[model samples]
Target: MTQPIRVLIVDDEPLARARLKELLSEESDMAVIGECRDGNEAIDAIGRQRPDLVLLDVQMPEPDGFGVLRAVSREYQPAVIFVTAHRDFAVQAFEANALDYLLKPFDQERFRLSLSRVRERRRTGATELDAELVERLESLSSRLTPASERYATRLVAKVGWRMRFLRVEDIDYLEAEGNYVCVHQGKQSFLTRETMNAVEEKLDPRDFVRIHRSLIVRLDRVEEVEPLAPGEMVLTLRDGTKLTSGRSYRARLQRALDLPS
Candidate 1:
């Protein structure tokens, strides 16, 4: 007889895990080998258990689902089916080339479809991570969390094994750093893997303005705006730090600040 497919379920919520377990139990060719409560535990389980498939939750404390993927050794990584509560992440999840992205409250039919895809991939012996999938997942790092229609009032960031929460009001400015965005608050800055555009979309436009391609400044933090040559301008924050506004962004900045030209 062929061996059953080994599967590991990872989710922070007990009910979520239980639900997945119940759904997966109906599959005769799949076996639940292990389960994890969070990203760190998932990483260890993935490395040690070496399951054939992983049902990973997108939102978790600190490391989260993406963090677990990043932490796992390439050789130990398995085919992933991302289970998210929000449909907003569907685009990014599929872009990462996951076997399937299941939105929360999915019925048994949907669950079976996801499992079927994994089974088909296994039969085809296509399980290796490719360059395009890696790049897409890397791009999805920051957008995974804060996937809601409501504006974000706080931000979640990972520092080592711990997760830090920063209120939107506490942020003084934001800077784009590669795949990450540096969240600048009083006397400190924390990095999150989300892109500037993603975070910007979550922020209230009335409270922040993008003065440069890489910069977003809190409106209340602006101390002065000095015009440079032609369309260029310099923005001085309350803390005395200066940021140059892109020539193309000058008019938008002016409109945001309501400055008469």
Candidate 2:
């Protein structure tokens, strides 16, 4: 008989933690060794229990899932499966070399698939996470923390064959194209792998605001907001480039401008 896969669950939400526990309970090969309500608790639990696998929430009150992982990596390391609601951070999760990511509201089939990978990694003795991967994961995790109170001052993007860093303030606007985001700055546009939602969250709200689901404009660059139709508005930039603002975001645009809604 094979040994049961000892698992630890870490999440801030009681309901989310309960749901995962309930699902894992159905698996005879998996056993819940411990549960943590926050990242700090998770670190202590990981140290004490030394579970084989950890189902961790990416967002938490403090020390977050990544912080907990970093703490574990330093000492009691375990295979990790990130549970997140945001799809935009998939690349960052992969860069961390996480066994798998289970998106929020995930179905049982997907959950089972992630567990399969974890089991395979364990059986093959193929898990070999390096220092470089950990550093990159930590950097990306810090950049994605919404409440960190630090705006992205610079962005790394590819230009032709070379990569360059662009100052955030120099960006005029951002447009979501398919899975990529086109960052406009001084008549030049750069394509980035970052989602518009992720980039928008990193920007200071006072300087950048989302005017449409696919568009974010720099407030300082806006010349005027002109009515394009009955409910739509067109934002004219100081450089005379026009970007359309969706009707649903009119109130948000007004609020950003400190104008009456």
Candidate 3:
């Protein structure tokens, strides 16, 4: 007979762990081998138990989910299903056939779907950690932060010799430059050290849109849109700052303007 999939549930909250446990109790092909409340315990449990699957919570006090992965990545590689309350900016990673992520407040249907993915992975006999999974884990490290559904109202940026808090509504657009993002405010620009994905996720999608690979614009600040060609265009902001939109994001720009595709 096929052995049941050994599972280890890890979460800081008792109810969160219990909720997963309760769900797992009903599944016939799964077995709960252990549980951990923090990253430290999780690391120890993972090493000692060597679970087939880990439903890991991303946020913890000292050692986070990323930390747990770093500690045991070399010697142990288990199929992981991350539990995150924060919205995913690592959509690319998830779409890359990496392990998986289970967002907070996941329903029974979603839970089963994640499990099915695991089953499919095991069925295919491709359980070893690969480059795609490594990329996914690295992506998570950059975007992982405390959970908040509220959009960012302001941003802290570094000026010549001081730091400044700039209001989000006042900013006209954002430009990506390697590791830093330039926040344009009327005539002044402030630079902040952050990834584009990290900054974009904090902004309200209704107010901002990624018009180009390296640019994000405030919707209301846009004054004009001119089509340069099929799947290409130019945008004029209220301040007369014209920026071109990328071909890949033309559809999104159109949707922001309520234009038919």
- Tens digits of per-residue lDDT, candidate 1, 19-87, equal 999988999999999989977678767867899999999777645676667666766558888888876
lDDT scores of the candidates, listed in order: 0.80, 0.79, 0.80
Q: What is the C-alpha RMSD of each candidate to the true structure, in Å?
A: 6.5, 14.1, 11.8
Best by TM-score: 1
Distance from true location, Cα of 154 in model 3, Å: 32
Residue 103 error for model 3, in Å?
Answer: 0.9
Q: In model 3, which regions exceed 4 Å deviation?
A: 89-93, 96-98, 133-261
lDDT tens digits, residues 119-212, model 2? 8778877555455655665576667665434556766566765657778889999999997889999879988766777677568898999999
lDDT of 2 at 183: 90
In model 2, the runs with Cα more than 4 Å from the true position are 73-75, 91-98, 130-140, 147-261
Better of 1 and 3 by TM-score: 1
- Candidate 3, residues 5-86, lDDT tens digits: the string is 9999999989999999999998899999999998767877887899989999877653567666755645568888888777
* Positional deviation of residue 160's Cα in model 1 after best superposition, in angstroms: 3.1
Q: How accurate is candidate 1 locally (lDDT)?
A: 0.80
Angstrom error of the Cα, residue 7, model 2: value is 0.4
